[model samples]
Target: MKTELLEFENKHKLLEPTSTERVATLEAISEYTENFLGNIDTLPAFVNNVSEKAPFIQSINFEEQNTLNEVLKNIRLYIDTPGINPASGGHLGYIPGGGLFYGAVGDYLACITNRYAGVRFASPGAVLLEETVLNWMANLFGYSKNYGGTLTSGGSIANLTAIATARDAINLKAKDYHKAVIYTTQYAHHCLQKSIRILGMDDVQWREIECNNLYQMNVEELEKAINKDLNNGFLPWLLVASAGTTDVGAIDPLQQLSEISKKYNLWFHVDAAYGGFFILTNKGKQLLKGIEQADSIVADPHKGLFIPYGLGAVLIKNKKLLHKTHQYLANYMQDASTEKVDLSPADLSPELSRHFRALRLWLPLKIHGEKPFENYLNEKMQLATYCYQQLSNLPDVEVFNKPELSVFAFRFLHKELPLDKYNEKIQKAVMNDGRVFISSTRLNNCYVLRIAILSFRTHLSTIETALTVLDKSKKIAEDELYQELRNN
Candidate 1:
């Protein structure tokens, strides 16, 4: 038995590499990353013609030990090469997440230390670090010192936490789920609906308030809907507004919506996952004026602050309600039950074994300061305006709403081909060209292209390149349509 124990221990020691081995591994990883970053400017944002059964899929085997070089080779070829290169500056699709180098370094240090930040007794310093970051966000959004929040994996979970807290604040019971009424525009992020389902409140009455041509919710219609619900004996419980919507960057009439929510006695929650951090800029502050009045707000650092993905925050004005919703106790966690100056993240969020996510945001803010992030966000808004102007100038293009933040939709027109079909062809051509990536969404049942400019790496030059690509793709799509017509 002693000999067997010694053999097992020796085998386990392999998991902790020697100092020399660690250095070599780090060097190799550094070299690969440096090369990738060096050519990032020239890399295609989208890679077409990906194989259905790539080599990486076949290489997945855990029975055999592989060299570090071989592992990186597989990652390069199979993981990073075949799809949208999110790290590329040309990534102008859906909401773009920033991949800051300093954030990655912070993640490395956090993983190496492996601090359990969920409980204060386990790691008081780690807990304080997270609390400090959340407090900073709360203050930025104009919350009082009584505010509380927790860092989540991303906006989805953060929004879920907000919804759960709102539900419990009223002591809503399962039997009354059918009577609860929630209000939001059609453009509200789908995560809210998912949250309702997850919380077993799917039967709650949902009123999609009408929006104006600019996509801002129509305040008069919203009030009418609320009154209708009230007359019908339905409880108006929550109002979810957008600071920046995903599709067109539309900001609902926030100040008006807040006023209505207050008057109607409904909880006002703002989903600013894509545009929350914009509050750092002067224009953003003016645009998001009424956001400070929200009962709770969901924001993503990865989106506005240009940090790498996986960092989101939720701020609730009433700290006690947040704690009441998510707090739990178990016998095994008795050691962590001691009272402390700060509330544990585990008490305010559903997660218990969460990653040390605060380090990523903290390191970047400390190293680069807040000025650069503000500048980048302001730059993105300007770039979006520039792109909108350029697209509107084209003879055959129809521009949609002017960007409220840094996103808008547009579509190309062709005389011979159906409008939707022609725009679809144009979208395909641009993606196949692979110089820059763009996405599409349907508005009023018409296909339209979308550009979301939020990546810290994106600049005026990148937007110009996208314009050039659009021109080339337009010609290609036209020729293809003509050829198909002739063939028929």
Candidate 2:
């Protein structure tokens, strides 16, 4: 039996590579990433060609050992060749956050260490570092040292956590769910509503407050709805606001909304996932006024901070409430139950085990400093203005409201055809052209092209490329759509 065990261990020895083999593997990976980065400026923002049938998928067998070279080749072919190139600066669609190289290095370090970041008892050093960053964010939002937050996978989970905390803080139970009232703008991110459903409060009343001409939440409509709910004997408990909505980048009248929430004793939560980091800019500070008043706020380091797309945060002014809402006890976790030092992340989030996400955010901030990030954010705002100005100058384009942050909607004006149909063709044309990527959304029942300029790598040149591509794609789409109409 001993000899058999020895043989089994020997058979799997390759899993623990020798020093030379480790170096070789690291070199191969570094080379591949270096090449990718070197050519990023030349890569298409979107690729239309998709081929699922490949011998490479069939050829690889996980049971057997594969060389690093083979794996990289497969990555280049099947993984890298098709779909959106998120790392490219030309990825203007949605809100693009550039994958900063320093962040990648931080992620690599995190993976290598494999620390248990969920609890301080397991890794005190890791927890301390995590708290440092979270504290930094808390301060940015005007939260004091007593305030705390949990670093989440993204805005969705952060939002869910915030909602759950709000639920428990209000002492809501299953029976009260039916009578509770929640308020949000129509343009609020769907994740907020989804969180309500997930928290088993779907029976609660929700008011989709109207928006103003700029698509910002109408404070009057929100106030009216709260009063109407009160008159109807429904308890209004929570109000959600968007700092920058996904569709039009509109900021809800936060100060006014905050006052309403306070007057009615409702929990104020801000989904600043897309625009929170903009607070670093002077203009942003003015635009996002009253964000400090939020009872809870969710921000995505990925969207605005230009980290990899995995870090989100939920800041609660009341740390005790956040802690009590998520902490759980079991026999196995007894060792991690000590209450000394900073509160464990496991006590503030749904996750009992989580990756060291702080490293990815911290490394970039430490290496690059806040000045560059602030400049990048301010640049995005400028680029949005520039794009809007250019689009307005065009003979066929119509601009939506001036951009409040780094996104806005516009579309080509078709005099004789269905508006959406022509815009759809143009959208396809732009996506197919594969030079610079942009997205579209329905606004006031019309399909409007959306330009989100958040990627840190996206500079004036990328915008120039987009304009040129838009011109060519517009012509192509017009001809194709007109020709189809004539034939039909």
Query: Looking at candidate 1, what is the lDDT of residue 64?
Result: 79
The C-alpha stretches of model 2 lying farther than 4 A from their native spots are 58-61
What would the TM-scores of all predictions be? Answer: 0.98, 0.98
For residues 1-488, write the lDDT of model 1, one tens digit per residue.
99999999999999999999999999999999998999999988999978777654586667778799988988888888887888888999999878999999989999999999888888888888998898889889999988889999899999999999999999999999899999998899999999999998999999898899998899999999999999999999999999999999999888998999999999999999998989999999999999999999999998888888899899999999999998887889777766734679888889898899999999999999989989989999999999999999889989888998999999998777888877888889989989899999988789999999998889989999999999998888888888988999
The per-model lDDT (C-alpha) reads 0.91, 0.90
Clashes of each: 0, 0
Clashes counted in candidate 1 amount to 0
For candidate 1, what is the TM-score? Answer: 0.98
Q: Write the per-residue lDDT of candidate 2 for residues 199-249, one digit (tens) a residue.
A: 888999989998989998888888889889989899999999999999988
- The residue-level lDDT of candidate 1 at 399 comes to 85
Cα shift from native, residue 53, model 1 (Å): 2.2
As a TM-score, model 2 comes out at 0.98
- Top candidate on lDDT is 1
